[model samples]
Target: MTTVTARPRAGRDPMRLPVPRRVRLGLLVVHIVATAAWIGLDVALAVLVFVPMLDASWTAVCHQVLPLLFWPLLTTALLSLVSGTALGLVTRWGLVRHWWVAVKLVMNLLLVTLIVVLLGPGLADAGRHGRALAAGLPDVGEVPRLFMPPSVSITLLVLATVLSVWKPRGRVRKT
Candidate 1:
């Protein structure tokens, strides 16, 4: 009996599959654009959060407008996450291969989780409250704190962007 082993092709490493440069570039572009969109959405939300302070009646209007942004915000966040993960997997960085990439992956995951679990429901509640306010009903006194979500999201996103740009840390040492 003979045992045979197949070897990698000439000049190619079996462990490192080559991803097309164009495909990687496209993924990078998508990741960047999606991240920028998410940041923009957060900025818009922050601006809306301040509206109530300026005009009390605009509070209902701002809250009503907030729900409309939910879908777009979610879409952008998911796009950024998916594209970033794809880029990391396809490129030299294998998701957790590098410290910066790993940190980014964690931040992205956390942001997405918060968006789904907290932000979505908060937006819905704000919309409902807005509707009630517009209906002339007495204030239910449950003013949803809208500032924190966007503020926190923006901060994390900017930090992620910085990590991406700086790529400060080296690869994670294998145990």
Candidate 2:
């Protein structure tokens, strides 16, 4: 005859030892939703919203709205960065083990840096100066400025997303 043990059970479920699917799904959903929203806002801010403000003789409004986008943009960017990092670490989708992931990480870093540092500042300055030009206010400078960084940052973002989706293996695959 066998004697029963006094211990009820282990402290935690064995399944919990593995990463939860819901956590991964939540991260993906949040990243996708935020990304889509950010793109929509970018287009809206650039074409629909800001242009209308300019049309309505509210140049100052453009400046206000333009700067306002920076906060959400920064937040989404930060979320994307954090979630992407977590996903990379947890899933190990060849991120740490392979070169492509490293490349992608570098690309993402450049993209985020450009947006966080370059694009927003350029847009803000241009918006303010452009608005002033639109109005009768004194010119900050005679030269016209363009927000090229945003365009470049968006391009990098799309490229990185495509790379992540397609997972085009460069040297790692052939080996």
RMSD per model, one decimal: 2.0, 7.5
Residues 134-162, candidate 1, lDDT per residue (tens digit)?
A: 88888897877889998899999999999
Residue 18 lDDT in candidate 2: 40
Let me know the TM-score candidate 2 reaches against the reference structure.
0.68
Q: Model 1, poorest ten-residue lDDT window?
A: 9-18
Supply candidate 1's per-residue lDDT for 120.
90
Off by over 4 Å in 2: 1-17, 45-64, 130-135, 142-144, 170-175
Cα shift from native, residue 164, model 2 (Å): 2.1
TM-scores for all candidates: the values are: 0.90, 0.68
Deviation in Å, model 2, residue 39 alpha carbon: 2.8
- Model 1, which residues run further than 4 Å from truth? 1-17
Q: Please, what are the lDDT tens digits per residue for candidate 2 over residues 1-175?
A: 9998764356543222247889878877886776666666566456523463447555555554566677777777777777766667656464455566677677767766866766677667757765676677875763223345445556667776777788775544544
